[model samples]
Target: MVFFFLSGKFDQLQHAEPLSAIKTAFNQYFFNISKSDDERINTTRSSILETAGDCIRVLTACFPGLEKIIGSHCTNPTKVGPKETQHRFEYAFRSMVKAIATPSNPVVLFLDDLHWADAYSLHLLTVLATDAYSLHLLTVLATDREIKNFLFIGCLR
Candidate 1:
């Protein structure tokens, strides 16, 4: 099994960026899988790029500059309602992650210090958590010892 350590902790010196953990995770997946000459990795890499690009184009607000990372153009697509677009974004990301994980090679995403994650990041995490039951994927989340907002905890449940 392959493990991808995705940290949600923001640098204290810099401002918290939206989708930083997601971007970092995708970037790691993009580069790491691209290095292999194996046919399965090649196919998985292409799947990740295509699905992630489609979703990122729709979700540029949450993932600024992400299209460039995936080598996609920042073209304006036909606008859909925000809620519909968000659903598409979440579904696409779920598909991308599923493409990487197989019975022989499961993927683990370790997200640390999730309390510092932005609202959009938390929403995406919740979506992934809800879908994890069906995928060969495991998500490990860590937060500070003291959670200031019980509402945030409630929402994640």
Candidate 2:
């Protein structure tokens, strides 16, 4: 399997290259392979929360009102019940749909800590990735674990 690892501090994502890389991937999938089943996944851990926050800020600037919607629920990163996390992610996914539907420009949703994410978060991510083309969305995920479990296992199956 092909795996990409994003390590180090969260602030590093503020640098243009990482964000640009994400944008490039979105463009590639959206424009070049409209009908093809190409899947792009991002994996990160809790260490990059600040970076993920920065990425979301950039996305908000691109798509106004998105920050308010997603920022409200994505506030704290504590461990929570599966149902609660799923609800939060559903809210987040709705925000993403709004942003994508309203704007001419593309939007990227960066999930920065897959390794630490709860089951609901992972389930939402899986749903998003599986339906990315229909939704017109780009998801960037980050994780630290080598062995795939939980969400990763679901992704495999």
Deviating ranges (above 4 Å) for candidate 1 = 1-16, 38-41, 46-77, 132-134, 146-151
**How many pairs collide in each candidate, listed in order?**
0, 7
Can you write out model 2's per-residue Cα lDDT over 54-137, one digit (the tens) per residue? 234334443343332333344344567887654544554444344333234345556554444554445545665665443545
- Report each candidate's C-alpha RMSD, comma-separated, in the order given: 3.9, 13.7
Q: Model 1 misses residue 8 by how many Å?
A: 4.6
RMSD to native, candidate 2:
13.7
Error of 1 at 125 (Å): 1.5
Best by TM-score: 1
Please identify model 2 stretches exceeding 4 Å from their true place. 1-103, 132-135, 146-151
Candidate 2, residue 78: how far the Cα is off, in Å = 29
